[model samples]
Target: MFTENATLMLYVENVQAEYDFWKTAGFEILSKETIMDYDTFDMKPHADSTLTFKVYDKAFIKQISPEVADFQPSVLFETEEITELHERISGLTDNISPITSTPFVSFNFASPSGIYFAVKEK
Candidate 1:
């Protein structure tokens, strides 16, 4: 069975814009390259992280798999410093939700393409 996740793919409308958002939000970029003549970015939560976040153009995916073009994954990020990270990210995007504790102290934020991701204390 598959266990380790080397990468998670994020297909967005604008690759460069989404890539910039993650970069500005403080994600470490591993590399930027062209796959199938399309721009793709590899990023991770930190420099030593094993999990990679792959950013690709939605149009490219649409061409390859039309049915999954609009599929956006629900990403939840765990951090030891939730409040601190939230505060730092707040300056980057205006579409961030205020922190709430339904069970754990957490909040949600949107990307440039209106895809929301969650962040919670570990």
Candidate 2:
């Protein structure tokens, strides 16, 4: 049986920009390398975090697996300080939605690559 989430594959057009975005949002880089003529990076929330996000350039993925190059999974992250996190990421992009409480205290923020993700209060 599956135990836990270890890594998630993320495909984007630009690796450097996404790298800066995640770094500015408090994510720590695990590793970065040039593979198959494309830049790739592995990042996580912190050192001890169980989950990881492996970033890859879309063009590279297209060369390897054209059919799956456009699949982007929706991610929902949990945080204890929802408001603080939202405030911190506010200046990063204008596509962020303000914290809403219709169903829960949560907000959605988009990465520089235009993939939006949600953060909900835990």
Candidate 3:
């Protein structure tokens, strides 16, 4: 048997809004596709890797028992495009704000679902 990583998918409340947020967070558009059950769009900077966020109907959360506040944030994106992303996202979200220098210059924000994310130049 063989296995390969495909994508990191996040279930979001508003697909277009979350998509725009990540765009502001520095990820480039990868591709967009739809399945019988849902609509999804992926964004990434490289060919070998992908990050996808999907928006589905209420049934999508039908069995989500745990409180969303208890759900930990899932991924981090590192990029040299941080500045442009920061500017783009900051205007759209009240939660987006820049952080001081660390290993990389970065910013943090929340998705439409309130999932937190940080992006830094790598």
Candidate 4:
């Protein structure tokens, strides 16, 4: 059995930069702590779940899991103002793709740390 609280941890080359990116994108900072001498930031895009980032060395990560360096994990978010949010993020990150429609209108963009996520209209 699982509890309502859940967290997704993403190891990044720069934890502060990733935290800043998400904070600027409107994700609320829940807390911050140090783990294994590495800075960790806990944030929440919505109240249901928490997203955490831990600082990691790219070289070490590559040696341990080479695929992780190139891996782009998709995190889907629902937004009421899809166009407005997309336009706002477009000015910040250049990795945003054109809005696409299949089942619904959505677009994907990468954070400053190159973590990709999708935003769909709710």
Leading candidate by TM-score: 2
Clashes of 1: 0
Candidate 1 Cα misplacement greater than 4 A, ranges: 1-3
lDDT scores for all predictions? 0.89, 0.93, 0.63, 0.75
lDDT of 2 by residue, 5-87 (tens): 68999999999999999999999999999998899999997777889999999999999999999999899999898888998
Worst 10 residues of 1 by lDDT: 2-11
- List candidate 3 stretches off by more than 4 Å: 1-4, 20-38, 45-58, 63-72
Ranking by TM-score: 2, 1, 4, 3
Order of models, best lDDT first: 2, 1, 4, 3
TM-score: the better of candidates 1 and 3 = 1
Candidate 2 structure, TM-score to reference: 0.94
User: Candidate 3 on 28-113: residue-level lDDT in tens?
Assistant: 77766665564567776455563444443233444454344234445677777677767777777888777658766877887776
With candidate 1 superimposed using the best TM-score fit, by how many Å does residue 60's alpha carbon deviate from the native? 0.5
Error of 4 at 54 (Å): 7.1
Higher-ranked by lDDT: 3 or 4:
4
Q: Judged by lDDT, which candidate is best? A: 2
Clashing pairs in 1: none
Question: Can you list the residue pairs that collide in candidate 2?
Answer: none
Question: Stretches of candidate 4 above 4 Å error?
Answer: 48-72
